[model samples]
Target: MTNDDLQFAHDRPIAMQQHDLLDRAGFAQRLALAISSWKNQESLVISLTGSWGSGKSSIKNMALEQLAAIQGSQVIEFNPWQWAGQDKLSSAFFEEISRVVQRKNPTEADKQLAKVLRRYEHRLNAGAAVLSGTAKWAPILLGSALVTTALGSVAEGTAAQVTIWTVSAVSWLGSLAPWLKQAAEWCTKRSKNLDQEAKDSELTLSQIRAELQKLLSARQKPLLIVLDDLDRLSAEQLKAMFQLVKAHMDFANVVFLLLFQRDTVEQGLQRAGFDGADYLEKIIQVPFSVPAISSGQLEAVLSGKLDAILANEQQLQQRFDKAYWDQMFQRGMRPFFGNLRHVYRYASTLAFHCRLLRGTEVAEVNAVDLFALECLRVFAPETYADMPRHKALLTNNEPFARQDEPQRARINQVINHLVFLAPSTHKPATRQLLQEMFPTLDWVFKNTEYDRQTQLRWLINSRVCCDDVFDRYFELSVPEQDVPNSLLHELARRIVDSGPFTTLLASHEEDRQAEILQRLFGLVDEFPLELSLAVVQTLLQAGDVVGRRMSFTNWSPRQQVVRLLRLFLLRHDDEAARSQLVIEAFAVGPGLVVVEQLLASEYALRRKADFGCLDDAGLEQLKSAYLCNLRELAERDPEAFLANPDFESYLYDLNRYGEGGDEGRRWSERHITSTTRFLQFAQTLVNTRSRYSGDGVTHIDEISLHSLDELLGKECCADWVARLDTGELSADASQILGLVKEALAHPARSETAEWND
Candidate 1:
């Protein structure tokens, strides 16, 4: 898995061992023809460009070995980056060529030249004698004499051993020149040559020109010198390396073969002040662009690595479970695109991990496992090191601060893509709302700026994102009518299960919580009950406090949320567990049966009037408020409050509100019917007051059958009306008179309205 465990033997192409090269027959044939052309032409340069790990190195290595078999051809298989200047480049390349030609096709001349070089080097080493027994001046004088005799300088004598070492190196080169010239001549003869001089030291540009003339004496055959693996170079270094190749090597017999990444290479070429297209053509007569591997090819590569564990005799056609494997492949393919390097790495790591855990290698891995592992790998320190922005945003910034634009934008991008590779965001309306939530993200880069279609595409291509569900959610945004369906679902579940959200929602009102409840109901078919519980609880809490009190006159996000909850809860069935919720909605203000629904419900006692949990004091506060407000309304125009359609239900529930069992119900019938009659009487008096005073006034006409007896209870009728009228209603003699009218409106002779008229 690492460089230490595996050695890449240059001669043996790994493609042959692993079946990754199977369907690449077309590519192989193209390479073969290209190689044949090179042999016929005598030299050439070919670029094998592809996404990371598309077998460029493997294929190039294989082709080089095959080319090495040619009789007259000699490949200088060296990376120019190994040295810095033109002199070092020329010296290293020509020296390697000299050594290879001598070793591979050693004539008697080459053999004698080699012998001379070795003997001369030995003699030079022996000649450096340390004069131990001589006087100190004698030793210095001896050193000076040797330096002047050989290296030709008095100053050089002080470092006499170093001077002698330089002489030996020169001698070695002198001895090897014959073979070097012969190889250079052969290269020149086979292709368009640069002229060169016959004398070794005189072999400059003029000599190169002469060499070109000699090479041109025959048909012009281009010689290619390929140098791949430039992808491993640093950005600036890669540009410099290519510049060296362009300036020194792009001439007569040679075309330079340079392989690098698309983006980096283009940028490098641009920095070097060369037209990338023209440079590519000049360096590569026929550039072999390796396209991203297909899904099918990737599968073959994965399967080939596990061939030892799987049956080789069985073809991929029928050996595996087609349906299951297809699903796994689809899932696996989701995270990665055409980057074969990452694919191989992912597969290898997964295979190794699988072997470690299961004791057997798996041919195909589960998509989820692959995805998680890939996530871990990408988020690892080494991978994250390559992405500074992602590192800074994810680590240094907090997503919660609304005004922190940079952090907010980063978090939005992260959430939108579910990863940090691209600046992810939704469309107009949804994006606007999101911006409101995290204001600082408003300036994020637009999607159109990148070549990808969706945020998902950018993430996948960048090898940073892979969650399909998360991607799809952001891809589709609906802010007009409601939050997108997926957003709703995600929010509902998230709010429900989150403790903070639960607490926030629990403190709000009922009607305000109903809207979200409706959304919850819609999703109950898919989301589980536990999740629903969390969501419902949140809505109830929010509605209970902030939501119910919210008014359109003072709109805000908190108020809106409460309003939504109200609409939500109104549609759901009243349950004992939701009893406090029911009261909170009614207690917020008034709406009769709606209020009666809570006041008379069994859960009234269950709601402890503390904070979100309504207790007896809270309920009493609501009761007192309602009564106080009602008394004020009645005094102004008693008919107005009593005329409300729900008045009867309100009185009925109030009479039976805290009573338990049938006897309580009987008392409720008696008292509730009487209260209704009293209100009706009050309405009539208000109507008469209006008619007599020639001013408009409201009144109630309906009376119940049990009212007469309650009004005639000796102290009850006059005492109650007089108390109400003299106290809160003292200024409204007309309202008191209306109450008397309502009591008198019932048949005086009747035992009670409950019996008959």
Candidate 2:
């Protein structure tokens, strides 16, 4: 088999049948029993309610399928949403009833109704002659036949129009003809004693009941109507169905199983003319709730699928072990438990990835792999279309916004649950968290990056996690708002422990930590302040490699030691706080080399801040501190530094303190003075005519000095004069001309320094 084929094998979903996949064996049994209980009864109404995708429809389908197989009963599936706003609900009822009845014995109903239709057609063909004599029985026959024949006839084409109209008229008679005939007879008898119009309007409930009883008793098998997708129907439609059931309880030996999403069904039930629970009790004989799969079951299911795939690739089979599955679910998939829709989506993704990897074709993925992939899939949107949108739109007042009171409350609850997943140590941006927590909203705001105003609007609407505060530059609330605090904390824990959010955080820690530490340090590095000491301490104390890369001390001006000591003292012996500061300081140290560069530096060390180069406040503080030190030095050693030969060098360093500003000019100025001094001092050190020059103890070759003269700039010569200070010009001053000739060979400093001057 090609690698692709093997890959496809592993990519098969862990479970294939959604309708039967849920472990609802017990629930299914209960539903079947309920059906059985109502099968022999005259009539039964069942309302199946559960959360969306809670297996209400699945269980209902299962029960009907089983009933059809075991009891030879007729089962019909109805969607009330499709029949909404119909003037006559009775037609819809029969439409569904016709579907089920036709399935049980198509020929019997078809032939019986067809014969009745043939007679009606003949009467119509005979025109007014037949109609005039048949008028008495004709009206009743036509009305009964029209209602009965309309049954399954609606589905047939116009080609069958005559047959359909005939059958409909006949079927109508089959169901209500007897009642109509008896009502007419009774009306005729009663009219003799009373007014005809008055007697015609006087039908009794007993007559209707007797007719319904006769029709129901004639059926051998019960009618099973599966009302699926009630959850999708509007409240009005659901209420109408309830009304129909209540008004016609003794219609037939029928079982109406109404299926709907649990919460939606409950809400619908409440709106459908009865209290939610009370209405449910009246219609639902047995309510079976499908529970979520246990963590153990999830693991088992993944392991089983992985094992099957691993069978082909023994080399990678070892990776699909049980323990592996445990870790994957615990770390990767457990965070998402809202529904099976997500679980199945995650599994399919993992399988496809395993197929993508040609060499390590783990046809089977353990629960761990399943979960890990799930996390990756959640974090990475290109793999699934949903995540990118969540990341994009979740920020704003659009759909994700915390605006709609109900949705806002739900978003708050989700945020509260997310507390354990926030990245406290390396906190992610508000948008990042919201995307993962609320993917739907992210999908909405894909391209609002350039418009800060739009982005802000989203932030206000969603108020997702700390983003609401972060956007407004609000500090985390003190004493912690119970909901947000728990949510942020949990989010931190979850991101660190498992999930795509953590992977993304780890991937971008360097840049993000640098940014946050820079902000936090700038705020408190020099001055003391009370913030979330606990949060800071936790992050700084984690000692993660990423955290160590940040020098919190450089974030502010005070001595690293002093800042910690002050915070410790002011905070009243906060050991956690103290330890955090101490550890960070110890990790970063006093900056002895960096300090010397600040103080006695030879080359000018520019402060990034001086040129507006310090993008964040942290770097700006370092600039502030360096400038402060320079100010202090100028105050204490003004005259010594000015009189000292290196005084100009000191000033030059200060001038070049920022990037590229004034450094070159300062060098030129200082070099001009020093170069002039060296040239005059060089004349005193050696005779112009002599080839040798020396300090008293050491003689230097004259030719060598001439060569050095040509090689070194006037600036270097002046520096040499200060080093080898000798007095008087040489007797052979004219010989200086030759040395000047050599120096003139190179570029002259100015027009005045000529070779033959």
> How many clashing pairs per prediction, in order?
66, 54
- Name the 10 consecutive residues with the lowest summed lDDT in model 2: 470-479
Q: What is the C-alpha lDDT of each candidate?
A: 0.41, 0.43
Tell me each candidate's TM-score: 0.36, 0.38
Which candidate achieves the best TM-score against the true structure?
2
The residue-by-residue lDDT of candidate 1 on 298-403, one tens digit each, is: 6665555444322321222122444534543454333343445544555555443433222112212222333333333432323223333343343223334444
Off by over 4 Å in 2: 1-22, 37-40, 86-90, 107-209, 302-328, 349-757
Best by lDDT: 2
lDDT of 2 by residue, 1-757 (tens): 4434543222222221243454765566666766665544667777666665455555665666566557745676767777766333445555455445545457664344333323322222223322333444444555454533432232221324434464445445566656554543433343232332223224444553554455555666666677777777677777776666665566567777777666776688677666866776776665655556676666555555556544544434433446534543454445554345444555555455544331332221222323343443444333223323333223343433544456545545543334324334212322233343333343333422334334422222222222332221112122222112222223333322323323433443454544332222212322323433433333322222232222322332222222323333344344344434433332342222233232332122333323211123423444445545444555575444334333333444455453455532333334434433434323332322312246433322222343233333455554544443444445444354334434444434322221210
Return the lDDT, model 1, position 249: 47
